[model samples]
Target chain A: MSEFFQQIINGLSLGSIYALIALGYTMVYGILKLINFAHGEVFMLGAYSGYFLASALGVERYSASGQSFPLGLALVVLLGAMALSALLGVTIEALAYRPVRSAPRLTPLITAIGASLFLQNAAVLLFTPNPRPYPPILREVRFTLGGVIVTNIKLAIFVVAIVLMIGLHQFVQRTWTGRAMRAVSMNMDAARLMGIDVNATIRATFAIGSALAAAGGILFGLDQITINPLMGVLTGLKAFVAAVLGGIGNIPGAVVGGLLIGLAEQLTAGYLSPDYRDAITFLILVVILVLKPEGLLGVVRQEKV
Target chain B: MTLVGRRWFCIAGAALLASFSACKKPGGGAAPGGSGSVTTNESSGLIVGHYASLTGNTAHFGQDTDKAVRMAVDDANASGGVLGKPVKLTTLDDRGDTAEAASAVTRLIDVEHVNALIGEVASSLSLAGGRIAQRRGIPMISPSSTNPKVTQVGDYIFRVCFIDPFQGKVMATFARNTLKLDEVAILKDVKNDYSIGLADTFKASFTALGGKIALEQSYSAGDTDFSAQVTAIKATKAQALYVPGYYSEVGAIARTARRLGLKVPLLGGDGWDAPELFSIGGDALNGSYYSNHFAPDGASPKGKAFMAAFKQKYGTEPTGLGMLGYDAAALLFDAVKRAGKLDGAAIRDALAQTKGFEGVAGTITMDKDRNPEKAAAILKIVDGKAKYEATVGP
Candidate 1:
């Protein structure tokens, strides 16, 4: 029973990060109707930024002395990483996607892929192709809840993810730029005629989505204690699947899909053969798609606010 | 003689006859190749071909191996040229891809017409290159490819390093006799042939030695998360966790295991030897033990000499793979000198009869399967360094 509960906690912890990455894919698709294949690399760049941030802030020196990082310093590292990732997201959009915006539909898609490859290789050149140890931010503390094991880092990840998602929901519902984003997502020409700056709104969406992905990256580094250039490839693929599973343009649906995917993955790995965890996760996506094409939480056709 | 011994004798006698007949001809070193074909090199000297990962994710392994191999060649030339001709080397970059490895070997054999081949630190890449070398009847020796399937490519495929089974058994023996653990859990990488091969061999050998496997689980390579597997092990009666995986995954696994509070001595194979292992695993790896070919520190006398020479040449301490590369080249040069020719069959025969040859890594004796039966070094991770533990004899 404790093992079952432990697996659930594990699933939810992983699911939170997946949701963070899925939100990026979902938001980009919601705005431009184009799947940003490079979103995964954005997440990777986020982790690298966090690594740099920690190193620059002397967290590495503090960490090397076997001390847990202070809360204030940890927050600074997280925010700094997110800010840098936002810049990177905007840069990628301006450089890679914006040029091909008015081109053939397949052009942007292909450019997205090329951008993905470029970012991955650039990271290799920038960071070198070695797994770097992410400085431990918080001294690890484990909490047992009714025989189930939960670590402080996992809990923090879960809380941060939920809070960010809720904040994004509120922003989209209540803010002017959010209104412009929704309007543009609904009908770009109509929103353009209504004086909404579609390009800026789309860039903001990338910025927000990328920030969330960065948060996920930091949390992942904290959890796994290592970061690498190609770390995002499979993870990004899984998050992309999560987005599709939740409804590509549905924000809340992405969260649901990510959590479900995480839970399914852990349960399959814990109860059945770990070899089939990936195959089974993909199978669920297929089964869900076959049964309800839109997604569990997604509405058919009427996708926009 | 035993049937196998008699067969070896017959082949050696035939090779001798072939060499004598070739000697009677105008130009020597015209001995027959394995595939009943002959390669004639109009170019100066014996051109030795090498295929390496030169530029890729594993480029460091390539660079290290390349340095040691060239140094070995330079040493040979400094003493005397082989067969009255200076040995010339041509190396191609495989970029750590199997397709590239295959193509590189093909180009080396087909275009350069190299007399002998050496290289490939990775087992999978070695397997890829070895097939072409075997098909073309070119004698190839891998410096550090440790998979059992590598030598199984053909009689032409050989490795200076011990195979996975040998290292696996070494660890298993250490675990049973040294660590004295009767039960353990295994968390392996299903996606890696190295991890799976090592795990399988360790499991079999440990079980044979009267140890019980408490539980078994697996994860794929590139997987950073191991909560499910670690939790399952935590629920078991495991005294230790045997994780036969590469350093990248092994380090992460160790961190997770420690974080989950499943404190047990970790056991691994040679794949766990890397500087990154310390940074990634940190203090989690303190109690873990791994089997390796040789240690950079506490090396044999010959190994020390090779390391000193390597440091003089490259201005850095040599890695275990570097020593293996040097040994592979040194062994090849010795065999070529003994063969007194550039013939594939003669070189192959000479390599097969190798016994008590003092390599920098160890005194190597070629087993019938073309692998070296050697003593392995077991090292424990103390703090951030791999401290030498005990030398386990095969």
Candidate 2:
């Protein structure tokens, strides 16, 4: 019915944001073989950066009339956040991950958690623990498609998310750096033997993944209309689950997982009780883990003793 | 160090520390209540301890209360201190957590040796702190915790603001009488006691008033998505939506509801009063209504003077929570003056007998339950700002 169709639209938009953030987790895990728990904090930082950039540009002052959609200003702020988040991502990798790379696997994992907590507290200390309302960048305009109300912001989020995914896909398939990334992910020692600079490749992967997450953060702020220091915690966890469900470290699987998780969450909330939304998302993860072990698109690999 | 020697040393050390703490407790208690032998020099000034969420999710509530409390203390000291001695206020940050609130109260009672306590804007936090103050027999007053269970903690606990049941009825009445909306949908935060209590009361009152509830949905606190709930409510084609949750989520809900083309005006409770409401809800909340403790935009002479004084001190408009803080402190100060002593039992008796205490929020008279019987104000969001509408009384 119309209500069903309406939920689908909501699911897709929500799924797109999850997908954008999932790509970051998948790419970093693909290259580093490490779950970057701090990636969520990176997403939070991106939202804050975008918030500051928009404020610096006087987006609020100009949009006070509520009639103007400052798309250009929004884009500028988004791109600025992307760039800053990339830098932060690279810096975190260098300081936190690189130092503990040779240590036990648990060491780096703990470091990632530590880094996440540190960044969250630092944001709290800097910004004060109040939630800031994200500036209205797009005017509130709605259009109906067969009884389903779709806003312009929702359409823009879907379009931008798809575009970014396509751009990332093409970059990975067609570029030399992308090939180097795939090479490192396959066999870091072998890639080094093949004259590939593994460290640079890893940094590049982090940068690109972080840029994608930043885009997700900005879009989420726009969609939800509020951003806080702790906003990234639950969201980051969900996207990580999405990546796992899609088969962690598999590019296409992350997209599929993100969309499926989004759809499942929205459908569950719409049809059932909202209290079960988070429970259902994790339940899917458990079912997938129990049944397949490997993700939907994940490939089984043989270990040589 | 041999094993036996180390064991004896540990036992001896623990005993020494225990005795020291035991001695300190009676010493601290004796100075205030004249019940023990130990004497202290710092008992000359009447100390009032306050704990609130000054640095966490609900920091705005605590920060506003802290400002208003400070203004009240300054005014009290300028006129004449309580018990003819300077009244000192000590505020601790509870970070909006129950465990932290309990610990904060413990510190105030045991360490600071405060004669009285004020605090904990959130009901859950107040419940935690109130239990501690009740055990210690310290008179504690909450500025804006509206849950009835707050005062039910103990006879020593009190609140200046009206409870959630009254607030819920006020909003329900406004919806049925003022807006004349017959069918409504309620989206409540199931994880929060305040929201659940308010929603229940509103639903009961609305149904009793011959108004039908078209739909009812629930969400947990801190949830960012209300799409499913909004869609469900829209499908019901209700005349209005009642969201009994805090401003953080309500603003997002309002935006989501409007985006889905549900044009009926949203109704809410005092939790919707916050500066962030405008920023998040924007023009989408233009015509929504909410019942509040006191509308800062009202034209009462007492309210106007309080607003002017608060603005002069804080350089911002006083929020409803801030006004409640000022009123609670003023009420407590009046009780202290009436008690004519720094004794907690005496102060509790005075607070119980409080009648017609003129506060900036309203004239308050404490019932047997220690809840202030006062009028609730209804405010409408017009052009992205809250305008005072009407005051509904019990």
lDDT winner among the candidates? 2
Q: lDDT for model 2, on a 0 to 1 scale?
A: 0.87
Docking class of 1: acceptable
Query: Could you tell me the TM-score of candidate 2?
Result: 0.92
Cα lDDT tens digits for candidate 1, B1-394: 2574476468557656754453223212222232213446643567778888765655667778888888887787777767776676667778678898998888788876888899798788999999989988899999998889999999988889998888889998999998999999999988777788889999999999999999989998667789899998998899999998877788889989888889998999877766667778888998889898898776988899889888887788877888898999999988988987788988899999899999999999999999998889999888788888999888
| Docking verdict class for candidate 2 | acceptable
- i-RMS of candidate 1: 10.6
Where is the poorest 10-residue window by lDDT in model 2 chain B?
B23-32
After superposition, which runs of candidate 2 have C-alpha atoms over 4 Å from their true positions? A65-70, B1-42, B297-300
Mark the regions of model 1 whose C-alpha exceeds 4 Å error after superposition. Answer: A102-104, A302-305, B1-43, B54-60, B296-298
